[model samples]
Target: MKTRRVFLQRAGISAVALAMPTLNPLLAMTKSADPLKNYAQTLRVAIMGLGSYGTRVAEAIQSCTRTKLVGVISGTPSKVVEWREKYGIPEKNCYNYENFDAIKDNPDIDAVYVITPNALHKDQVIRVAKAGKHAICEKPMAVNAADGQAMVDACKEAGVHLLIGYRMHFEPNTLEVVRMRKEGELGEIRFFQGLSGFVIGDPTQWRLDPELSGGGAMMDIGIYSINGARYMVGEEPIWVTAQEVKTDPVKFKEGVDETITFQLGFPSGAVASCLSTYNMNYLDRFYLNGSKGWAEMQPSTGYGPIKGTTHKGPLTEPIVTHQTVQMDEMAAIIFDGKEAEVPVNGAEGVKDMKIIDAIFKAIKTGGKVDLTFG
Candidate 1:
């Protein structure tokens, strides 16, 4: 059977090569049909927020054939100046947060990738949507469910695509597991375990501030587990039970949780156990158990180079920058109406936010919190 790759090879052949099968070599050197061609031509993007993650996103985008960074928005004037010079962006393409709304008038920037602090995502995404550009926001998506809904509503009103920075949605190995589950290779999923955490070294970072980051490990790092639970089990949770433990009030602060253990009960009779913390290293992993088989992903939800295995075999997918694949796919999604292998829409993010909210409520009251996504 001729796949798309084979089709591209045949399309590149000379008339003589069409007549011969065994010895034709010219077609082999021809480029496979570039799936990103249309996106590469149409997607002009901007990076909002020039922080560490923003810088890395910008750099990763340079490798994306489907997207180009044409503008920048930053609160820090010095960083804006440096970025404009570095990317060769015209003066008209630069903006500060206060003046960013004027971007609605610019035609060059087709999308805005928001990489600001957690609390700022709601307002910033609203503004970006109003500016008539597609909104690609960093994860947790917002400080809480309410803010996530506001962002979603704003984008819906503006008729713009709202994509959260769930890079694993585009990751090859991770998506393979999702494929396996959908294919029934995992049979009926009965149990799942999601673990995500890190020893956040800087006590002064924004992640520790409840107002800025929304919550402690649960907000900043635990979301990986939350999302993993949903995707691995392939069902929306019906209820949540949680417990919180904190050892350092100085570092984690009041109104913030240092560590949390939560359980999610799915409608399919599958249950997930999750652990989230701010005092562990290389702590991202997932285990899904099913009637016929099981899958395990260690170093699963981290930034890159994921390693894992399943009942069938080991994950042999090559390592690539999660951000690189994400940006390219985002470009295609906005410009060509391309759907993600797994949805990364704002609605999907809001569902996770609702689960997080339930988890927090469960911890506060020491009771099971019911959840329903309709």
Candidate 2:
């Protein structure tokens, strides 16, 4: 799959000189006093489109101490010789997808996660930020919001870091119910419901291809009820309204999508009632309400022991491995500039792709729509 003359022969130039712009030596290194002991002596990651959630993020980055899955970029050469003998890797840090921008001359790889197919995540995260590395991707980061803000302006004009898998922002009982609804204990908040779906089963995969899943089950499981109703109604929703219910229009063709129900409105007059489906089954749940009390989670965005309750009680919290604590808290928010209580960058994935473009423009203008995220 990788042949543009093996990416212009080891990227020896021109794809506009491997996308010009540069200068980001790990964002000029510095801040340390034990940046997790210098990011456990170097982060070193790599995996771009190996599929099955990139083998569950390379087995949860082997339970990441700091995060070190050496390298890989497969376009299937026997799945890159079966993940280079199951992750021993090396062979110039193995890559395909056309030489993967010569991994910018490989210094044993620093980052490049992308996991592919959400319309190829804005050109593989702008070619992993024009190959200067650091890019994480995944989630519904693109296929909208102008290709997720052109992959966050090509990783901020190539200074790097783009992150956005949003692994429930490092789940621990969903950040303890987003830190008990920001310590007010769900008090003045108003509403939220987010019931994400399931029940999809290969109607010819590539997620039922709307040109590789730009939409279907609301861009795959209704973007976990639109990013769990903006982190359980903490805010940011201006407006949106929608409805769609394709009972298999020949396997949800015409730009995909199947079963969607949305609403959002927030601005302290908070509101959200969502559902996204692919012919549901045990739909995951998340609920929040308040003027005084409420919170709930039932298999909420599963991929662990997430179960909950609130109005004070039963959250439990110690169930780890949501992609191994999101690659060890994204190696301390990319080498210790640390700051993700909830945001998972690329402008929090362009505010959930501008609320999935105002819920597909309020499902084609049946009304509501207005939204504005800064």
Candidate 3:
């Protein structure tokens, strides 16, 4: 009866809509005026890193209607000057890493987007939380689960929102696939595969430094696969097993991983086989198979134009700028109480960190590591 009533109501609405062609002009005028309410609440953001990814995000933010880049936090003074000039940022809105705590007094800046190295996320995000502003940190939120939890606790205690930059969570093609899985367009999930990697050229960069990076390929490129597995399978992994392989000790060095192949077993008997590597190229892909249907993606987690196909046919979702959509959606989440389809909050980052911790332990022990997530 509930379904019948809903269907009848939809039919009535369709008939009214067809009959009310003249009403659309009035509706459009009303809709035009309604946008001013949302526009008035645009979020002012400060990005904390001046590196390549930070630059990408700053450029992407120019297109975001709901989120604006108004300030910057960088250790390099020269980059700060250049960015301020380029982005029309005022001197008062800028601060170096050592002095960013002063941002707490600046009411114009509402949030800080931390795009620094993996090891730096914990301290930086905690600081942002303590300043009584929201934090948006990049992936691999911390070096380990303990630090990730500490960031989560700090934000909770300070009463601020802590969001991880899981930009794919807002991507259209990715969301459509998740929607299909939830709507049973795909039946019970059986298996998933994620391959995320790239060849590293600069051996001297911060990404290769254990102190800054926390780990090698797994922390950098491998995280996408670990994150992708859970979202695609729609289940937290119960256990993980991993094996590591290193060819060049000179470049990779101690405490840094070169490549890892990990498996995640879910509670529903679903399993994931994934690979994370630094020496491999053209490895960005995700595949999911279920009892009734399958979806496959190549170049799955890249910056833009994430293409995919399902058992039905090609995924036809509109291609969108990932970072632009992400920031705008994040603005809604931080201010307007919007809930994402998959969580992009600090707890979600902690869950990924827990899996990474288990993966590293599994590599060292040559045994399976069990996981428990609430």
**Residue 25 miss distance in model 1 (angstroms):** 27
Q: Which run of 10 residues does model 1 get worst, by summed lDDT?
A: 21-30
- How far residue 240's Cα lies from its native spot in candidate 3, in Å, is 0.4
Instruction: State the lDDT of candidate 2 residue by residue for 81-148, as single tens digits.
Output: 88889888877888888779999888889788888888988988898788778899888988799889
Give per-residue lDDT, candidate 3, residue 155: 86
Clashes of 2: 0
Ranking by TM-score: 3, 1, 2
Off by over 4 Å in 1: 1-41
| TM-score, every prediction | 0.89, 0.34, 0.90
Per-residue lDDT of model 1, residues 128-245, tens digit only:
9888788999999997889999999998787778999999887888888999999999899999999988888888888888888889899888999999888888889999999999
Q: What is the TM-score of candidate 2?
A: 0.34
Which regions of candidate 2 are displaced past 4 Å? 1-37, 49-91, 97-114, 118-137, 140-164, 167-177, 180-184, 188-190, 193-217, 224-255, 262-272, 275-289, 293-328, 332-374
How does model 2 fare in lDDT? Answer: 0.79
Clashes of each: 0, 0, 0
lDDT score of model 3? 0.87
Clashing pairs in 2: none
